[model samples]
Target: MASTILVTGGTGTLGSHVVPLLREAGREVRVLSRHGRASADGVEYLTADLLGGEGLDPALAGVETVLHLAGGPKGDDLATRNLVRAAARAGVKHLLYISVVGADTMPIGWFRAKLGAERAVAESGIPWTTLRAAQFHDLVLDTVGKMARLPAVPCPGGLRFQPVDAREVAARLAELTLGEPSGLVPDLVGPTVYGVAELARGYLEARGKRRPLLPVRMPGKVGRAYRAADNLSVTGALKGHRTWEDFLAERVGQ
Candidate 1:
């Protein structure tokens, strides 16, 4: 089991943490990335681009369990489908995937793509488990931080976010990888939920910046979905304990 575990997106936010934990547990970890960088000692780095369907079969040669985390701005479904096909060809045992909480019902391009990817996973014929998680705290804060530079920062109204920590998600993924494949595990969310405006203010406070908050009410289906708080999983697994404030204090306060 240890020698056959392969983690895609090994250089990303969640994968960075997941790979080390796997290695530390004495699992022989192999990473497949476009950049192909060595993250840990004795870990193998395989080159592949899922969307292009290049170099995947070789990567899956000896890999049994694949923790799929690689994604991009678009073509998420294509990438996942490619990987799924390759996994099936390689006779992979279990496929673990990372997805967003609202991917199933949300009316957005990214969400739709993610949902499509989920379908591909389900139909792949590989024993699979997918964990839908709330937004990551770092991603939320990064967005807010980028907008905080403007004189007036725009905030979406009635939008609630339960931002989980990437490391916390990584830990859960590790646990899932170690265990048997349970199809579509419960969502992993943050300890608390906060409005977008509240998160924006928190970001401003953490960065020691003062900007006028311009509340925006979005005018489309996507905006309506956000307004309805579709992103918050009230009855989810809620595995993450780190709050946005905790993330801010540790990452931004430093």
Candidate 2:
């Protein structure tokens, strides 16, 4: 029997894509979530809180591989530290973590938290792989969708994104999870880089809506980091096939 692999945040968007791929590979899958769930589709569901470190011992018992996909706007460092401690005690062989591109470069609180999470995984004393990915098309869509609701969209100049499909990231993660630990793999990103204005315009065009875009400069060091494209992986990155336009066409224009 294939050893069971535990996935945290398996119910979220990225996890939604990843869980099935693992199942298709004939691996017994376990998902750790905050709420209780019934086992279905060959996946065992376990209730645990990564942040408060509750129920982890039970969750990690006999699990050799862990995909640490659970994260949030804050406290990711603490949550990851909590999970790593348990994974260590449980004798997990391989630990995989999903982090964001520019987690170490961007001067933002969320980025800092992600970097901290990365640190925790690296220091966990277990074989680990961490893949930093660019922003997902779904997340960008939400950002632009909310912006479209305003009369005139505040398009922050120098704010750019390479929005990749979540499914593509999931596939990559599944491939990595099944293999040996490869530390800090090359980043995964979309095929094309787009300015924030370009992304917003694409969304507007897809929805058949019209909105004037106000060009505004982002201030402070945070803005400087964006302007420098610190959040992008323009070189030495594995690019996904789908473009922002393709995603918009399928999700909005259709």
Candidate 3:
């Protein structure tokens, strides 16, 4: 029998891309969803909620590896705790978690939650691998557009980012799920690091709109940490093939 891999948040942006690749690799993929949606071809969809702890046991039964991707937007610690306990009960062999780059160094609440989740996975007694990746290109573009809509793009002064392609990240994640569990692999980053203002300019250019990028000083420890270059990875850990310009041109059209 093929090894079963349970993918949490299987209908999400990254999961949509990942599910197809896992199926193509001939693995039995099971998606944990809340709505109990119909399973995709060569994949199974099971209803499970991380917070409610509902339908987790049967969904995890016979699953050797778990690609844990579900978590609260702001606080992942509680959800991660529940997942760890459930995985322990199910006798899961390996757990692969996807985290953000600079999660440990950044002072943002979201990053803190991610760090807490990483701690849980490390101490869960299940062999685990955690991949910390830079912000996705789509996420960067979306944020820029949203800020621009406010009539001003707020770029934290001197903040740098190495935004990566979500597709590539998903591919790497699928590869990790099939490999041996290693603790905290090297951070994955994009081809280059660009200033937030430049990123915003590129976004506006793609949309054929001109907008002033207002560099503002955010007032808080988290804002200060975000303004620092420590949020980005300088050393290329996981090299992405696509560039930001390429992504924008292909997706948004030049």
After superposition, candidate 1 runs with Cα above 4 Å error? 38-40
Question: Arrange candidates by TM-score, highest first: which order?
Answer: 2, 1, 3
Lowest lDDT 10-residue stretch of candidate 2: 245-254
Query: Candidate 1: TM-score?
Result: 0.97
What are the TM-scores, per candidate, against the unseen true structure? 0.97, 0.99, 0.95
Taking the tens digit of each residue's C-alpha lDDT, what string does model 2 give over 1-254?
66899999999999999999999999999999887789999999999989899999999989999999988889999999999999999999999999999999999999999999999999999999999999999999999999999999998999999999999999999999999999999999999999989999999989989999999999999999999999999999999999998998889976
Q: Per-prediction RMSD in angstroms?
A: 1.2, 0.7, 1.5
Return whichever of 2 and 3 wins on TM-score.
2
What overall lDDT goes with each candidate model? 0.89, 0.96, 0.87
- Writing each residue's lDDT as its tens digit, candidate 1 over 40-143 gives 59589989989999999999998899999998888999999999999999989999999999998898899999999999998899999999998898789888
- For residues 77-170, write the lDDT of model 3, one tens digit per residue: 7777788899999999999999999988988788889999999999999999999999989888888878889777788886788999989999
Q: Which parts of model 3 are misplaced by more than 4 Å?
A: none
